[model samples]
Target: MAAMWLLRTLLPLAPFARRMRHGMTLGVRAIAIGADRRVLLVRHTYSPGWHLPGGGVDVGETAVEAARRELLEETNTRAIGPLELHGVFFNPPVGGRDHVVCFRVPRFEMGPLPAPTYEIAEVGAFLIDALPETVTPATHRRLQEVASGAAPDDCW
Candidate 1:
């Protein structure tokens, strides 16, 4: 009975399965913040939770490039040189993996901050110790480590 049920499900997704089998998976994520102790976050359109401003890495792009690109695209803020490597995490119980690069960015003191774009609805500097309630669990954990000054030179 179980075998028959599995076959039924597979039969309906045969075309999708074929397409997926030919696809390559790759991704990058970032943890960006400023010296003011405010981190960059985006409120996702699909999910109610807030997360770092990053997405999948393009096929030919380096993880660092992807992280910087995502941050600029999502928040219009450019990071300075040297992004610290925090941790790399795998998307468990799901597909793909992530190389999470963290940066303790300096504030945009040269000029006014740019408005948030993309799926982000709003953007503002918030105290790291008093983050909003919309942050995701994993993100919250990262924030805690950042706040506690315990994020060592190792993977999380």
Candidate 2:
């Protein structure tokens, strides 16, 4: 948790720190809706509110690979089938060149929840009809899009 806090504090300086790097940055988020009709969400140590389990896509990692990795790392869950690409949205508020790829993890198995880590603070399977009020707006929007079968928005 302290590590993430430090990273969050240093986040604004990241643009300058990464000025040497070229091109856009990519991230992955996994959206898992269970047979019980609940959506999996996670709270991060560095950020406020609940969000889809995810993180940055490493230098050579594919988005789906990142999604599966993050889902297990953050929530002790594993995808058991193909993950469908939901959307790729520009996340300008996070960074000028940051874009997040969302995936629907339709077939997954959740192990017992892992204890909180430096990255993840908590995890929950929230009912579709009773989402937490503190869910991040972007996450909430994504959940709505999934629930309504609506086209995804361009922004994240």
Best by lDDT: 2
Among residues 3 or more apart in sequence or in different chains, the pairs in candidate 2 whose N, CA or C atoms overlap within 3 Å are: none
Model 2: per-residue lDDT, tens digit, 1-156? 999999999998888777747468899999999999998999999999999999999878899999999999999999998999999999998658899999999999999998998888899999977999999999999999999999999999
- Give the candidate number with the greatest TM-score: 2
Regions more than 4 Å wrong, model 1: 1-24, 96-118, 151-156
Clashing residue pairs found in predicted model 1:
none
State residue 47's C-alpha deviation in candidate 1, in Å.
1.6
Q: What TM-score against the true fold does each predicted structure earn?
A: 0.69, 0.86
TM-score of 2: 0.86
lDDT score for residue 28 of model 1: 54
